[model samples]
Target chain A: MSKQAGLPVLEQDEAVCCAPMVREPLGEEAAAELSRMFKALSDPIRLRLLSLIASHEGGEACVCDLIGPFDVSQPTISHHLKVLREAGLVGSERRGTWVYYWVLPEALAKLSALLEIPAVSAKAPA
Target chain B: MSKQAGLPVLEQDEAVCCAPMVREPLGEEAAAELSRMFKALSDPIRLRLLSLIASHEGGEACVCDLIGPFDVSQPTISHHLKVLREAGLVGSERRGTWVYYWVLPEALAKLSALLEIPAVSAKAPA
Candidate 1:
C-alpha cells in the first residue's frame, strides 16, 4: 500500500518485502499472505512445536525427535506441524520412516522484519 | 522449555526475552503469551490497521484518519483496533471527538526478536 494512505489500491509485487510495518500501510494482498503465516503461529502448541524444530540440533528435527516432550498426542503434534508447513513457515520432507522439519529462514525473517518498529517510530498515542 | 527437551517445565522469567526461537525451544508460558499477540495479528484487516497507524505522521493516527482506506464498516474497523490494543500491539487515547492510536514499539520489537531466525539456523528439511 501507499505510504500516504492514498485511495487507489495497488497490487503489491512483494508480499515479503523488507519494509517494516512502520514504513507504510500494508496492501490487502500482502496482509492476507502475511496474516496466514501469523495465524499458523497463533496457537501455543504450534508455536512451541515450531520453536522445538528450529532450536533442535542441526537446525532441524525429525518427527521422531519431536514426539517426546509434549503432553499432546503424536497426531495432534503432526497436525500443528502440518499447519506450520501449510503456512510456509516450515518445510518438511518425508524420509522413509520419518518426516523431518525445519524452519524456513526467509519466512521467519519476513515476519521478523515486518514487526521491527524502530525506536524513533515510538510515539505516544495521544 | 529446556534446550534438551527435558520433561520438567520451568518458569520462563522473560516472556519478551530477546533470544530468537532458533536459540532454544520456547517455554509453554511464553508460547501462550506470544500466541495471543499472534492471534491478534492473525486477521488481515487487523494487520493492515496496525501498519496504517504505525506509518502515520507523528507515528499516530486518529480514528478519523483510520476509517477512510477500508471498505469495512466503522464498527468492524473499531473491533479490529480493539483487538490490536488488547493484544498490546497498539495503544489508544481519546482526545475530544476522536480516538488516537499508535504502535507500541516494545511490543512489536519482542515479536520481531522472537521470529528472527538466523541464517545460520537454516537447514534443509530432509
Candidate 2:
C-alpha cells in the first residue's frame, strides 16, 4: 500500500499540482510518466543498489549479498537489479538459489511524493 | 541555498541513515554523485523544462515564456534548460534578450531529502 502510502495529504499537496517544473511544460503525458520514473533513477549503480536494499537487516537483500559490493558485471549487477525491479523500486523473491531484495517503501514514497515542493507554499505570489 | 535548503533535519533524518538502496551498492563515489543527479533527472525534455520553471508566476520563468509550450526545438528548449541548469535544478538570469528560469526550491528539497524513506522507521528486524 505504498504509492506514498495511498496518498492524500491533498495528494501529497498535489504533487506539485501541475504547472511548476519551471512554470509550464510537462505534458507529453507528463513527460512520459516522469521520465519512466527518472529512468529508474538513472543509475549510480541504481542508487547504490537502492542504498543496499534499503539498508538491509531484514528489510531484505541478497543477490549474493549484492555481489561483493560492486566492481560491476554480474551482468552489470544483474542490470541494476533489473532496473530496480522495473522501477517499482525493488521487490524480488526467488529464495532457493537466492534473490531477496525488498525495499519498496511505497516506491520510495512515490519518489518522495513526486519530488514535492509547495516550497513553503504561498510566497511566490506578490 | 537549495540542496534541500542546506540540509539538517538531522540531515533529513540521515537521508535514510545510510545502508539501504537494497542493502548496499551505491559507492562509486556514491554512485558517481547520485548518478550525476539522476542523469539530470533523466529527461522527458528535462521534466517538462523543470515543470515550466516551477510553475512560473514570479517563482520565475521566461525563455520567451517557455517557447510556447513545447514540441521541442528552440535549441531543444535550450538544451533542456541547460540540463536544468546543470542539475542545480533550474536558475538562470541573463535578462538581456531573454532567459529567466527559477525554481530551485532547494533543488527540489534536495530531491525530496534524497528520496527519503525512514518508512516509519524501525521494523525491518525479524
Candidate 3:
C-alpha cells in the first residue's frame, strides 16, 4: 500500500528541511508526519498521561504509580501509553510486571522547533 | 443540549489554571479543554491553512490568494477555516466579496506557553 494511503500526502525530505510552520504552509509530507504526532496528543487522557510520566520522580513513572489517579480502566490508560510510545513522545521499559515511562525530550523539542519563531531579527529602524 | 454532548468532558475554569501539560496528567476537565485546541491542529490541511494565513503579506491573507495553491474544493478550505475560527486560532473579516484571515497571535501564544518549560534556577552543585 502507498504510504499515503492512511496518511496525508507529503514530500518527506522537503518537510524535514523547511521554514518553520509559521513562515509557510507545511508541505504535505511534513504535515502528515507532524499531524500524526499532534493527533497522538489530541486526546486529553493521553496528554495527562504524558504529563504524569514526565513529572514523575527520577524523570520516569511506573504504570503502578499512574493507575491510582484516574478512574479509567487500567487497560485504557495502557492504550494511551502505547499510543504515546509509538509516537516517540515517551519511552517505556518493562521491569518485572510493571512498565515505566519517561519523556523523550528530543522528540518534543523537534515538535516545538516547528513552531519556534526565530528571535525577531533586529528591527529595521522604523 | 449539554456542552459536553459534542465535546470531551472538562472543567473549563480549572483547565484554564493548572500545571503545564507535561508536568501532570491533564485533569479530565483540563484535558478536554486543551484537547479541543490541539485537535484543531491535528490535521495537516489545517496546519498549512494556519501558516498560509499567518505568513501572508501584512499578516493577513485573502481566500482568493489561498484557493489557487491547493487542489481541494473551495468548500473544503472553507470548512477548515470555520474550524480554525471556532477554535479561536484565526479571525476573519469580510472585505467586499473576498474574506480575509489574520493571525490571532495571542491564541497561538497561549498554546505555546502551555508547553513552555520554565527556565532552570541557579543552584549550587553538591
Per-prediction TM-score:
0.85, 0.32, 0.77
lDDT of 3 by residue, B62-106 (tens): 888877768799999999888888888788889999998876664
Candidate 1: stretches off by over 4 Å: A1-16, A124-126, B1-16, B123-126
Relative to the true structure, how large is the alpha-carbon lDDT of every model? 0.84, 0.65, 0.70
DockQ-best of 1 and 2: 1
| Candidate 2 error regions (>4 Å) | A1-30, A37-39, A42-45, A50-62, A67-83, A88-95, A100-126, B1-27, B30-34, B42-45, B48-62, B65-67, B70-83, B86-97, B100-126
List interface RMSDs for the candidates, in order: 2.8, 10.5, 4.7
Docking outcome class, model 1 = acceptable
Model 1 lDDT, residue B26, Cα: 90
For candidate 2, the per-residue lDDT at B124 reads 55
Best by TM-score: 1
Q: Order of candidates by TM-score, top first?
A: 1, 3, 2
Candidate 2, residues A11-58, lDDT tens digits: the string is 323343332344344567756766777788777777777777777776
Classify candidate 3 by CAPRI docking class: acceptable
Q: Name every residue pair that clashes in candidate 1.
A: B1-B27
> Please, what are the lDDT tens digits per residue for candidate 1 over residues A1-126?
336645543323354545688988888888899899999999999998889888887778899888898999999999989999999999999889889998888889888988987655557432
Clashing pairs in 3: A10-A28, A10-A29, A11-A29, A48-B25, A48-B26, B10-B29, B11-B29
Work out candidate 1's RMSD over C-alphas.
7.9
Candidate 3 DockQ vs. native: 0.29
